[model samples]
Target: MNPPDVAAAVVVGGLFAAGCYLLLQRTLMRLLFGFLLLGHATNLLLLIAAGSPGAPPIIGAARIGDEPSADPLPQAMALTAIVITFALTIFLLSLVYRSRQLHGNDEVRDDAEDRRLAENQQREASAAAADPHRTNGSGQARTAADEGGNTL
Candidate 1:
Protein backbone atom coordinates (compact mmCIF):
# COMPACT_ATOMS: atom_id res chain seq x y z
CA MET A 1 0.00 0.00 0.00
CA ASN A 2 1.04 3.60 -0.54
CA PRO A 3 2.17 5.85 2.32
CA PRO A 4 -0.57 7.45 4.43
CA ASP A 5 -1.67 11.03 3.74
CA VAL A 6 -0.24 13.74 6.00
CA ALA A 7 -3.66 15.28 6.69
CA ALA A 8 -5.14 12.07 7.97
CA ALA A 9 -2.20 11.52 10.30
CA VAL A 10 -2.55 15.03 11.70
CA VAL A 11 -6.27 14.61 12.28
CA VAL A 12 -5.80 11.31 14.09
CA GLY A 13 -3.04 12.73 16.26
CA GLY A 14 -5.11 15.78 17.12
CA LEU A 15 -8.10 13.68 18.12
CA PHE A 16 -5.97 11.47 20.37
CA ALA A 17 -4.32 14.47 22.00
CA ALA A 18 -7.61 16.21 22.66
CA GLY A 19 -9.17 13.05 24.00
CA CYS A 20 -6.29 12.46 26.44
CA TYR A 21 -6.53 16.02 27.72
CA LEU A 22 -10.25 15.69 28.33
CA LEU A 23 -9.89 12.28 29.91
CA LEU A 24 -7.49 13.74 32.48
CA GLN A 25 -10.05 16.28 33.64
CA ARG A 26 -11.77 16.06 37.05
CA THR A 27 -15.27 15.97 35.60
CA LEU A 28 -17.07 12.87 34.32
CA MET A 29 -18.75 14.68 31.42
CA ARG A 30 -15.44 15.76 29.95
CA LEU A 31 -14.07 12.25 30.38
CA LEU A 32 -17.03 10.78 28.50
CA PHE A 33 -16.58 13.20 25.60
CA GLY A 34 -12.90 12.34 25.43
CA PHE A 35 -13.65 8.62 25.38
CA LEU A 36 -16.01 9.09 22.43
CA LEU A 37 -13.48 11.19 20.51
CA LEU A 38 -10.75 8.58 21.05
CA GLY A 39 -13.10 5.83 19.88
CA HIS A 40 -13.86 7.66 16.65
CA ALA A 41 -10.20 8.36 16.10
CA THR A 42 -9.38 4.67 16.53
CA ASN A 43 -12.04 3.66 14.00
CA LEU A 44 -10.72 6.16 11.45
CA LEU A 45 -7.16 4.94 11.91
CA LEU A 46 -8.15 1.31 11.38
CA LEU A 47 -10.08 2.11 8.21
CA ILE A 48 -7.20 4.15 6.85
CA ALA A 49 -4.78 1.32 7.56
CA ALA A 50 -6.92 -0.92 5.35
CA GLY A 51 -5.73 1.14 2.37
CA SER A 52 -7.91 2.52 -0.49
CA PRO A 53 -11.26 0.79 -0.70
CA GLY A 54 -11.69 -1.89 -3.39
CA ALA A 55 -14.38 -4.33 -4.39
CA PRO A 56 -15.10 -7.06 -1.87
CA PRO A 57 -13.06 -10.22 -2.38
CA ILE A 58 -15.56 -12.27 -4.39
CA ILE A 59 -14.61 -15.21 -6.64
CA GLY A 60 -16.83 -14.10 -9.51
CA ALA A 61 -16.50 -10.32 -9.01
CA ALA A 62 -12.79 -10.13 -9.93
CA ARG A 63 -12.07 -7.42 -12.51
CA ILE A 64 -8.89 -7.25 -14.52
CA GLY A 65 -6.57 -4.27 -13.98
CA ASP A 66 -8.87 -2.80 -11.34
CA GLU A 67 -8.16 -2.05 -7.66
CA PRO A 68 -6.72 -4.97 -5.68
CA SER A 69 -9.34 -6.87 -3.66
CA ALA A 70 -9.69 -5.30 -0.17
CA ASP A 71 -8.45 -7.14 2.87
CA PRO A 72 -11.32 -7.81 5.29
CA LEU A 73 -9.17 -8.10 8.43
CA PRO A 74 -8.83 -4.39 9.18
CA GLN A 75 -12.51 -3.79 8.48
CA ALA A 76 -13.48 -6.59 10.85
CA MET A 77 -11.13 -5.26 13.52
CA ALA A 78 -12.58 -1.77 13.18
CA LEU A 79 -16.13 -3.12 13.52
CA THR A 80 -15.17 -5.00 16.68
CA ALA A 81 -13.53 -1.90 18.10
CA ILE A 82 -16.72 0.09 17.46
CA VAL A 83 -18.77 -2.42 19.43
CA ILE A 84 -16.31 -2.53 22.32
CA THR A 85 -16.19 1.26 22.44
CA PHE A 86 -19.96 1.41 22.61
CA ALA A 87 -20.05 -1.05 25.50
CA LEU A 88 -17.36 0.81 27.46
CA THR A 89 -19.10 4.11 26.80
CA ILE A 90 -22.25 2.70 28.35
CA PHE A 91 -20.28 1.53 31.38
CA LEU A 92 -18.70 4.95 31.81
CA LEU A 93 -22.12 6.59 31.53
CA SER A 94 -23.44 4.38 34.30
CA LEU A 95 -20.47 5.23 36.51
CA VAL A 96 -21.10 8.93 35.91
CA TYR A 97 -24.74 8.50 36.80
CA ARG A 98 -23.91 6.67 40.01
CA SER A 99 -21.30 9.27 40.98
CA ARG A 100 -23.80 12.06 40.51
CA GLN A 101 -26.45 10.25 42.49
CA LEU A 102 -24.09 9.59 45.40
CA HIS A 103 -22.22 12.88 45.52
CA GLY A 104 -24.66 15.31 43.89
CA ASN A 105 -22.04 16.29 41.33
CA ASP A 106 -20.23 14.81 38.35
CA GLU A 107 -16.92 16.24 39.51
CA VAL A 108 -14.62 13.74 41.27
CA ARG A 109 -13.48 14.85 44.69
CA ASP A 110 -10.08 14.35 46.28
CA ASP A 111 -9.90 11.27 48.48
CA ALA A 112 -10.09 11.96 52.20
CA GLU A 113 -7.71 9.14 53.03
CA ASP A 114 -4.98 10.72 50.93
CA ARG A 115 -5.32 14.03 52.79
CA ARG A 116 -5.24 12.27 56.13
CA LEU A 117 -2.12 10.38 55.20
CA ALA A 118 -0.37 13.56 54.18
CA GLU A 119 -1.27 15.18 57.47
CA ASN A 120 0.04 12.22 59.44
CA GLN A 121 3.32 12.31 57.55
CA GLN A 122 3.71 16.01 58.26
CA ARG A 123 3.08 15.49 61.96
CA GLU A 124 5.57 12.64 62.09
CA ALA A 125 8.18 14.74 60.33
CA SER A 126 7.73 17.57 62.79
CA ALA A 127 8.00 15.18 65.73
CA ALA A 128 11.15 13.66 64.29
CA ALA A 129 12.64 17.13 63.88
CA ALA A 130 11.81 18.01 67.50
CA ASP A 131 13.33 14.83 68.86
CA PRO A 132 16.23 13.64 66.82
CA HIS A 133 17.71 10.28 67.99
CA ARG A 134 15.38 9.73 70.97
CA THR A 135 15.42 5.94 70.84
CA ASN A 136 13.14 4.79 73.68
CA GLY A 137 10.01 5.72 71.66
CA SER A 138 8.84 8.14 74.36
CA GLY A 139 8.45 11.92 74.59
CA GLN A 140 10.97 12.07 77.48
CA ALA A 141 14.49 11.57 76.16
CA ARG A 142 16.14 8.39 77.43
CA THR A 143 19.01 9.02 79.94
CA ALA A 144 21.25 6.67 81.91
CA ALA A 145 20.44 8.59 85.15
CA ASP A 146 16.72 8.25 84.46
CA GLU A 147 16.98 4.50 83.97
CA GLY A 148 16.82 3.72 87.76
CA GLY A 149 20.02 5.77 88.26
CA ASN A 150 22.27 3.21 86.63
CA THR A 151 24.50 6.15 85.56
CA LEU A 152 26.40 4.02 83.12
Candidate 2:
Protein backbone atom coordinates (compact mmCIF):
# COMPACT_ATOMS: atom_id res chain seq x y z
CA MET A 1 0.00 0.00 0.00
CA ASN A 2 0.99 3.63 -0.47
CA PRO A 3 2.22 5.84 2.32
CA PRO A 4 -0.97 7.88 2.19
CA ASP A 5 -3.14 4.78 2.60
CA VAL A 6 -1.04 3.62 5.53
CA ALA A 7 -1.24 7.03 7.12
CA ALA A 8 -4.99 7.14 6.64
CA ALA A 9 -5.37 3.75 8.23
CA VAL A 10 -3.34 4.96 11.17
CA VAL A 11 -5.55 8.00 11.52
CA VAL A 12 -8.66 5.83 11.38
CA GLY A 13 -7.27 3.66 14.14
CA GLY A 14 -6.54 6.69 16.29
CA LEU A 15 -10.00 8.07 15.78
CA PHE A 16 -11.50 4.72 16.73
CA ALA A 17 -9.49 4.60 19.92
CA ALA A 18 -10.31 8.15 20.92
CA GLY A 19 -13.94 7.65 20.05
CA CYS A 20 -14.15 4.54 22.18
CA TYR A 21 -12.55 6.30 25.12
CA LEU A 22 -14.97 9.17 24.83
CA LEU A 23 -17.87 6.78 24.51
CA LEU A 24 -16.95 5.23 27.84
CA GLN A 25 -17.11 8.64 29.56
CA ARG A 26 -20.10 9.55 31.73
CA THR A 27 -20.77 12.83 29.94
CA LEU A 28 -23.31 13.00 27.11
CA MET A 29 -21.32 15.63 25.21
CA ARG A 30 -18.32 13.37 25.15
CA LEU A 31 -20.48 10.52 23.99
CA LEU A 32 -21.85 12.61 21.14
CA PHE A 33 -18.41 13.69 19.99
CA GLY A 34 -17.14 10.15 20.25
CA PHE A 35 -19.99 8.91 18.15
CA LEU A 36 -19.23 11.51 15.52
CA LEU A 37 -15.60 10.50 15.44
CA LEU A 38 -16.50 6.87 15.08
CA GLY A 39 -18.90 7.70 12.28
CA HIS A 40 -16.27 9.66 10.41
CA ALA A 41 -13.84 6.83 10.89
CA THR A 42 -16.35 4.38 9.53
CA ASN A 43 -16.87 6.52 6.44
CA LEU A 44 -13.14 6.77 5.88
CA LEU A 45 -12.67 3.07 6.42
CA LEU A 46 -15.34 2.33 3.85
CA LEU A 47 -13.65 4.55 1.31
CA ILE A 48 -10.34 2.93 2.09
CA ALA A 49 -11.86 -0.45 1.46
CA ALA A 50 -12.39 0.70 -2.10
CA GLY A 51 -8.61 0.77 -2.68
CA SER A 52 -7.11 3.20 -5.24
CA PRO A 53 -9.41 5.73 -6.85
CA GLY A 54 -10.19 5.78 -10.58
CA ALA A 55 -12.28 7.64 -13.07
CA PRO A 56 -15.79 8.40 -11.89
CA PRO A 57 -17.88 5.29 -12.37
CA ILE A 58 -19.06 6.24 -15.82
CA ILE A 59 -20.34 3.29 -17.83
CA GLY A 60 -18.53 2.92 -21.16
CA ALA A 61 -16.01 5.59 -20.03
CA ALA A 62 -13.13 3.12 -19.69
CA ARG A 63 -10.93 2.40 -22.72
CA ILE A 64 -9.43 -1.02 -23.51
CA GLY A 65 -6.74 -2.06 -20.93
CA ASP A 66 -7.24 1.23 -19.12
CA GLU A 67 -7.63 1.54 -15.34
CA PRO A 68 -11.12 0.44 -14.31
CA SER A 69 -13.67 2.94 -13.06
CA ALA A 70 -13.96 3.43 -9.37
CA ASP A 71 -16.21 1.06 -7.49
CA PRO A 72 -19.62 2.59 -6.88
CA LEU A 73 -20.64 0.12 -4.21
CA PRO A 74 -18.30 1.48 -1.57
CA GLN A 75 -19.26 5.05 -2.40
CA ALA A 76 -22.93 4.19 -2.03
CA MET A 77 -22.24 2.38 1.23
CA ALA A 78 -20.34 5.42 2.52
CA LEU A 79 -23.22 7.70 1.64
CA THR A 80 -25.64 5.44 3.46
CA ALA A 81 -23.38 5.38 6.49
CA ILE A 82 -23.18 9.17 6.47
CA VAL A 83 -26.96 9.47 6.44
CA ILE A 84 -27.37 6.98 9.27
CA THR A 85 -24.65 8.66 11.28
CA PHE A 86 -26.23 12.06 10.73
CA ALA A 87 -29.61 10.81 11.89
CA LEU A 88 -28.18 9.16 15.01
CA THR A 89 -26.06 12.24 15.73
CA ILE A 90 -29.18 14.39 15.67
CA PHE A 91 -30.94 12.00 18.00
CA LEU A 92 -28.00 12.01 20.41
CA LEU A 93 -27.87 15.82 20.25
CA SER A 94 -31.52 16.02 21.24
CA LEU A 95 -30.93 13.65 24.13
CA VAL A 96 -28.04 15.81 25.31
CA TYR A 97 -30.20 18.88 25.03
CA ARG A 98 -32.96 17.33 27.08
CA SER A 99 -30.47 16.17 29.68
CA ARG A 100 -29.03 19.66 29.94
CA GLN A 101 -32.48 21.15 30.34
CA LEU A 102 -33.44 18.72 33.09
CA HIS A 103 -30.17 18.44 34.99
CA GLY A 104 -28.20 21.55 33.96
CA ASN A 105 -25.44 19.24 32.74
CA ASP A 106 -24.80 16.44 30.26
CA GLU A 107 -23.52 13.96 32.80
CA VAL A 108 -25.32 10.66 33.00
CA ARG A 109 -26.67 9.82 36.40
CA ASP A 110 -26.48 6.36 37.93
CA ASP A 111 -29.58 4.33 37.19
CA ALA A 112 -31.54 3.13 40.23
CA GLU A 113 -32.55 -0.05 38.45
CA ASP A 114 -28.93 -0.82 37.58
CA ARG A 115 -27.90 -0.31 41.18
CA ARG A 116 -30.74 -2.49 42.42
CA LEU A 117 -29.82 -5.27 40.00
CA ALA A 118 -26.17 -5.11 41.02
CA GLU A 119 -27.10 -5.31 44.70
CA ASN A 120 -29.34 -8.27 44.02
CA GLN A 121 -26.53 -10.03 42.14
CA GLN A 122 -24.12 -9.42 45.01
CA ARG A 123 -26.62 -10.82 47.50
CA GLU A 124 -27.17 -13.86 45.34
CA ALA A 125 -23.43 -14.48 45.04
CA SER A 126 -23.01 -14.31 48.80
CA ALA A 127 -25.91 -16.62 49.36
CA ALA A 128 -24.51 -19.16 46.89
CA ALA A 129 -21.12 -19.00 48.56
CA ALA A 130 -22.78 -19.59 51.91
CA ASP A 131 -24.55 -22.68 50.53
CA PRO A 132 -22.31 -24.59 48.15
CA HIS A 133 -24.88 -27.36 47.56
CA ARG A 134 -27.74 -25.06 46.59
CA THR A 135 -28.76 -25.70 42.96
CA ASN A 136 -31.25 -22.92 42.39
CA GLY A 137 -30.41 -19.25 41.90
CA SER A 138 -32.26 -18.41 45.15
CA GLY A 139 -29.54 -20.35 47.02
CA GLN A 140 -32.03 -21.83 49.43
CA ALA A 141 -33.13 -25.42 50.06
CA ARG A 142 -35.83 -27.20 52.10
CA THR A 143 -35.10 -27.61 55.80
CA ALA A 144 -36.92 -29.47 58.53
CA ALA A 145 -37.42 -26.21 60.48
CA ASP A 146 -39.27 -24.68 57.52
CA GLU A 147 -42.98 -25.35 56.95
CA GLY A 148 -44.71 -24.11 53.82
CA GLY A 149 -47.45 -25.01 51.29
CA ASN A 150 -44.87 -24.81 48.46
CA THR A 151 -41.17 -23.96 47.95
CA LEU A 152 -42.23 -20.44 47.03
Candidate 3:
Protein backbone atom coordinates (compact mmCIF):
# COMPACT_ATOMS: atom_id res chain seq x y z
CA MET A 1 0.00 0.00 0.00
CA ASN A 2 2.87 2.38 0.76
CA PRO A 3 5.34 3.74 -1.80
CA PRO A 4 8.12 1.44 -0.61
CA ASP A 5 5.91 -1.62 -0.76
CA VAL A 6 4.73 -0.72 -4.28
CA ALA A 7 8.30 -0.19 -5.41
CA ALA A 8 9.36 -3.52 -3.96
CA ALA A 9 6.48 -5.26 -5.68
CA VAL A 10 7.36 -3.66 -9.02
CA VAL A 11 10.98 -4.66 -8.65
CA VAL A 12 9.98 -8.21 -7.79
CA GLY A 13 7.74 -8.36 -10.83
CA GLY A 14 10.45 -6.96 -13.08
CA LEU A 15 12.97 -9.51 -11.82
CA PHE A 16 10.56 -12.37 -12.47
CA ALA A 17 9.94 -11.12 -16.00
CA ALA A 18 13.66 -10.73 -16.68
CA GLY A 19 14.37 -14.19 -15.29
CA CYS A 20 11.78 -15.76 -17.59
CA TYR A 21 13.26 -13.99 -20.59
CA LEU A 22 16.79 -15.06 -19.76
CA LEU A 23 15.70 -18.65 -19.15
CA LEU A 24 14.50 -18.80 -22.77
CA GLN A 25 17.96 -17.98 -24.14
CA ARG A 26 20.08 -20.65 -25.82
CA THR A 27 23.17 -19.96 -23.69
CA LEU A 28 24.04 -21.55 -20.34
CA MET A 29 25.17 -18.24 -18.89
CA ARG A 30 21.78 -16.71 -19.62
CA LEU A 31 20.03 -19.61 -17.96
CA LEU A 32 22.17 -19.25 -14.84
CA PHE A 33 21.41 -15.54 -14.71
CA GLY A 34 17.72 -16.33 -15.04
CA PHE A 35 17.84 -18.72 -12.09
CA LEU A 36 19.68 -16.16 -9.95
CA LEU A 37 17.14 -13.50 -10.80
CA LEU A 38 14.25 -15.79 -10.00
CA GLY A 39 15.77 -16.63 -6.62
CA HIS A 40 16.17 -12.96 -5.78
CA ALA A 41 12.62 -12.26 -6.87
CA THR A 42 11.28 -14.95 -4.59
CA ASN A 43 13.24 -13.54 -1.68
CA LEU A 44 11.91 -10.07 -2.42
CA LEU A 45 8.36 -11.35 -2.54
CA LEU A 46 8.78 -13.03 0.83
CA LEU A 47 10.21 -9.86 2.34
CA ILE A 48 7.35 -7.81 0.96
CA ALA A 49 4.78 -10.20 2.34
CA ALA A 50 6.39 -9.99 5.77
CA GLY A 51 5.70 -6.86 7.79
CA SER A 52 8.30 -4.12 8.21
CA PRO A 53 10.91 -4.56 10.92
CA GLY A 54 10.03 -3.61 14.51
CA ALA A 55 11.49 -5.55 17.46
CA PRO A 56 12.92 -8.97 18.04
CA PRO A 57 10.51 -11.85 18.72
CA ILE A 58 11.96 -12.56 22.17
CA ILE A 59 9.68 -12.10 25.18
CA GLY A 60 10.47 -12.09 28.92
CA ALA A 61 8.01 -13.59 31.39
CA ALA A 62 7.18 -10.14 32.84
CA ARG A 63 7.10 -8.43 29.39
CA ILE A 64 4.68 -10.98 27.88
CA GLY A 65 1.95 -8.28 27.59
CA ASP A 66 4.22 -5.65 26.00
CA GLU A 67 3.79 -4.96 22.28
CA PRO A 68 3.76 -7.16 19.19
CA SER A 69 7.14 -8.29 17.91
CA ALA A 70 8.55 -8.61 14.40
CA ASP A 71 7.62 -11.80 12.53
CA PRO A 72 10.55 -14.22 12.16
CA LEU A 73 8.82 -16.69 9.84
CA PRO A 74 9.49 -14.76 6.62
CA GLN A 75 13.06 -13.98 7.62
CA ALA A 76 13.74 -17.62 8.33
CA MET A 77 12.11 -18.60 5.06
CA ALA A 78 14.23 -16.10 3.16
CA LEU A 79 17.41 -17.41 4.77
CA THR A 80 16.53 -20.96 3.84
CA ALA A 81 15.74 -19.90 0.29
CA ILE A 82 19.08 -18.09 0.08
CA VAL A 83 20.99 -21.18 1.15
CA ILE A 84 19.15 -23.37 -1.35
CA THR A 85 19.71 -20.88 -4.11
CA PHE A 86 23.43 -20.72 -3.35
CA ALA A 87 23.72 -24.48 -3.63
CA LEU A 88 21.74 -24.51 -6.87
CA THR A 89 23.85 -21.74 -8.34
CA ILE A 90 27.04 -23.59 -7.52
CA PHE A 91 25.73 -26.79 -9.06
CA LEU A 92 24.55 -24.99 -12.20
CA LEU A 93 27.86 -23.18 -12.61
CA SER A 94 29.72 -26.47 -12.38
CA LEU A 95 27.43 -27.95 -15.01
CA VAL A 96 27.99 -25.01 -17.31
CA TYR A 97 31.73 -25.20 -16.87
CA ARG A 98 31.77 -28.92 -17.58
CA SER A 99 29.61 -28.47 -20.66
CA ARG A 100 31.87 -25.76 -22.06
CA GLN A 101 34.97 -27.84 -21.39
CA LEU A 102 33.51 -30.87 -23.12
CA HIS A 103 31.85 -29.11 -26.07
CA GLY A 104 34.10 -26.04 -26.48
CA ASN A 105 30.98 -23.88 -26.62
CA ASP A 106 28.17 -22.67 -24.31
CA GLU A 107 25.30 -22.25 -26.73
CA VAL A 108 22.81 -25.09 -27.28
CA ARG A 109 22.63 -26.04 -30.94
CA ASP A 110 20.99 -28.74 -33.05
CA ASP A 111 23.52 -31.58 -33.48
CA ALA A 112 21.55 -33.37 -36.18
CA GLU A 113 23.62 -31.84 -38.98
CA ASP A 114 26.94 -32.57 -37.33
CA ARG A 115 25.93 -36.14 -36.53
CA ARG A 116 24.70 -36.70 -40.08
CA LEU A 117 27.92 -35.38 -41.60
CA ALA A 118 30.06 -37.53 -39.29
CA GLU A 119 28.02 -40.62 -40.11
CA ASN A 120 28.28 -39.94 -43.85
CA GLN A 121 32.02 -39.47 -43.60
CA GLN A 122 32.36 -42.70 -41.64
CA ARG A 123 30.34 -44.61 -44.24
CA GLU A 124 32.46 -43.19 -47.06
CA ALA A 125 35.68 -44.09 -45.29
CA SER A 126 34.45 -47.63 -44.65
CA ALA A 127 33.44 -48.01 -48.30
CA ALA A 128 36.85 -46.82 -49.49
CA ALA A 129 38.65 -49.20 -47.11
CA ALA A 130 36.48 -52.13 -48.21
CA ASP A 131 37.18 -51.70 -51.95
CA PRO A 132 40.54 -53.21 -52.92
CA HIS A 133 40.65 -51.72 -56.42
CA ARG A 134 39.49 -48.26 -55.34
CA THR A 135 42.90 -47.25 -53.97
CA ASN A 136 42.70 -44.20 -51.73
CA GLY A 137 44.94 -41.36 -53.05
CA SER A 138 48.74 -41.37 -52.36
CA GLY A 139 50.99 -44.42 -52.90
CA GLN A 140 50.25 -47.03 -50.21
CA ALA A 141 46.79 -48.39 -51.03
CA ARG A 142 47.38 -47.74 -54.72
CA THR A 143 50.61 -49.79 -54.65
CA ALA A 144 48.82 -52.66 -52.88
CA ALA A 145 45.96 -52.55 -55.39
CA ASP A 146 48.45 -52.47 -58.29
CA GLU A 147 50.26 -55.54 -56.89
CA GLY A 148 46.95 -57.39 -56.64
CA GLY A 149 44.82 -58.16 -59.64
CA ASN A 150 42.77 -55.35 -61.28
CA THR A 151 39.72 -57.18 -59.91
CA LEU A 152 36.86 -55.24 -58.18
Q: Runs in model 3 with CA error above 4 Å?
A: 1-4, 60-67, 111-152
Ranking by TM-score: 1, 2, 3
| Local distance difference test scores for all models | 0.80, 0.81, 0.79
TM-score: the better of candidates 1 and 3: 1
Residue range 1-152, candidate 3, lDDT tens digits: 43567778899999999999999999999999999999999998998878775567766534445556778899899999999999999999999999999999898765655655555566556657777466453245345444442332
TM-score, every prediction: 0.70, 0.69, 0.64
How badly does each model clash, as a count of residue pairs? 0, 0, 0
Return whichever of 1 and 3 wins on lDDT: 1
For model 1, residues 1-152, the per-residue Cα lDDT tens digits are 56677788889999999999999999999999999999989998998898777778777875868768887889999999999999999999999999999999999787766655555456556657877676344333223224523422
Q: In lDDT terms, which candidate is top? A: 2
Model 3: pairs clashing at backbone N, Cα or C within 3 Å: none
Task: Give Cα distance to truth, residue 110, candidate 2, Å.
Answer: 1.0
lDDT measured at residue 144 in model 2 versus the true structure, 0 to 100: 17
What TM-score would candidate 3 get against the native? 0.64
Which candidate has the top score in TM-score?
Answer: 1
